[model samples]
Target: MENDSVEGLKKYTANNLLDFLTKQIDKDLMAALVKELGGTVETKTNSESF
Candidate 1:
C-alpha cells in the first residue's frame, strides 16, 4: 500500500486517488470536509477570507 512506501507518500487530491480505493484524511489535511462533518455550508458569502 502507499502508506508503507516513502515514494508513494506524496500529497494527492481527491481526483488523483485510485478509482477502486477510497481514502479519508483528517480535517487538518482536508479542510473542506468540515462542511459535511460539522453540518454547516460555510459558503463564500459568509465573509471569511480562508
Candidate 2:
C-alpha cells in the first residue's frame, strides 16, 4: 500500500512538471511569433485605439 502511494505521487509530480513545461513552451513560442510580427501587431492595436 505504501509503495502504491509512492508511485502515485511520482506520477502526479511528473504530470505537473510536464504541464508546466508545456505552458512555458507555449508562452515562449507566442512571444517569438509576436516579435517576428512586431510592426504588424503594433499597427493593428494602434489603429484599433482610434
Candidate 3:
C-alpha cells in the first residue's frame, strides 16, 4: 500500500511538471512567431499579454 502511494505521488508530480513545461514551450513558440512577424514580445511573470 505504501509503495503504491509513493508511485501515485511520483506520477502526479511528473504529470504536473510535464504540463508546466508544455505550457512554457507553447509560450516560447508564440513569442517566436510574434518576433518572426515583426511584432513586439512583452513578457509577463503570470501571463502573456501583447
Question: Each model's TM-score?
Answer: 0.19, 0.26, 0.33
Q: Report the poorest 10 consecutive residues by lDDT, candidate 1.
A: 34-43
Q: What is the C-alpha lDDT of each candidate?
A: 0.35, 0.38, 0.49
- Indicate which candidate wins on lDDT: 3
Best prediction by TM-score: 3
Give a tens-digit lDDT track for model 1, residues 1-30.
Answer: 235255433333332333223433332344
Predicted candidate 2 versus true structure: per-residue lDDT over 1-50, tens digit per residue:
22546656544543333334445456444443344432122222354411
Worst 10 residues of 3 by lDDT: 13-22
Superposition TM-score, candidate 3 onto the true structure: 0.33
Q: By TM-score, is 2 or 3 better?
A: 3
Error of 1 at 9 (Å): 27
Task: List, residue by residue over 1-50, the lDDT tens digit for candidate 3.
Answer: 22546656544543333334446667566565445444455565855646
Query: Which residue pairs show collisions in model 1?
Result: none
What does candidate 2 score in Cα RMSD to the true structure? 14.9
